[model samples]
Target: MSSAMTNERLARLYDRIEIQELLYRYARGVDRKDWDAVRAVYHPDAFDDHGNYKGDIDGFIASLQQRHAHIEQSMHVIANCIIEFDTPDSALVESYFITYQRVLPSAGDARANYFLREPLADDEAVQGQAIGRYADRVTRRDGVWRIEKRAVIYEVYRGMPTIPGGRLRDNWTISSRDGRDPLELLRIELGLGEAR
Candidate 1:
């Protein structure tokens, strides 16, 4: 390949890595329920459409805060990130995200953690399997890349505000990340594995 072609390829690869890292940060922020961190991933005037939300960046995130407050814990998984750059500073990205919310006990003794263990309840977990895509137009402003526009799409919303461990009570455990595979990490995060 010519020098110019080689340089272009390397630049594209770098851009892809950067976009993936940015997306991972976005997911981490959402999972941690850090609204401020989540907001920082976008431009000041970015647009978003999260199905449950349809507004500008600020308005959309405000709605997210209100909704997220009702859940106890959430996990956001993003994968298969495909970023296509229109220019060195601008791109469109489509990524897959799976979000899970642990529902709080609404009835019975929720605080009572210890009791005769029975079947896990279904009213305590909500899993969203989203074939979601984000359309982002990014630009480097002030020597930093920021998403100028964003749109979100959700493909599946499974389960509900029910207990996630109810069905798989015997499968909950921690993972020791000595050198875990990326796919394994994904499965564990998605509730597809027992506690290790």
Candidate 2:
């Protein structure tokens, strides 16, 4: 192959990796409640439809903040991602996710009722699991790839009462919404400088 062809192939590979990272960032941002990180994943004029809500990116973020505030913690695991390039500057991406959320009973009487069949004990919480997919229109603008529009489809979900004492205790180092993740220790081990 010609050098130009090899370089083009390499560039496409890099684009694919960058797109995957953007998806990972989106999941981390949502789980960590880092609104800024969420914002960075999308274009300024992005649109989102997440089943329960549909609107512009700002409205989407606001709605998430309101809803997630009631939850103690969340984790979104991406199981599969497929990207189809439409052009050098645009792609269609689908990402499958399994999400787990732990919400306190105080979210609201109505919302709590959906999760708890009976009243939750003071020491217990509600755990929810969801299987879903995010279908996104991604575009490259100014040399950066970001989501231009997205639609979330939930395949199934269930909630159950969590057993008492099923949480970490006395762990000083934990993940944070402000970008502090215990996994950063890996950087130190690898002789890299301070982790951001």
Instruction: Find the candidate with the highest lDDT and give its number.
Output: 2
Tens digit per residue, CA lDDT, model 2, 34-135: 788799999999999988789898999999898887677688999689999999999999999999887765674644643747665665668889899999
TM-score of each: 0.68, 0.84
Clashes of each: 11, 0
On a 0 to 100 scale, what is the lDDT of residue 115 in model 1?
24
Candidate 1's C-alpha runs over 4 A off are 105-131, 164-196
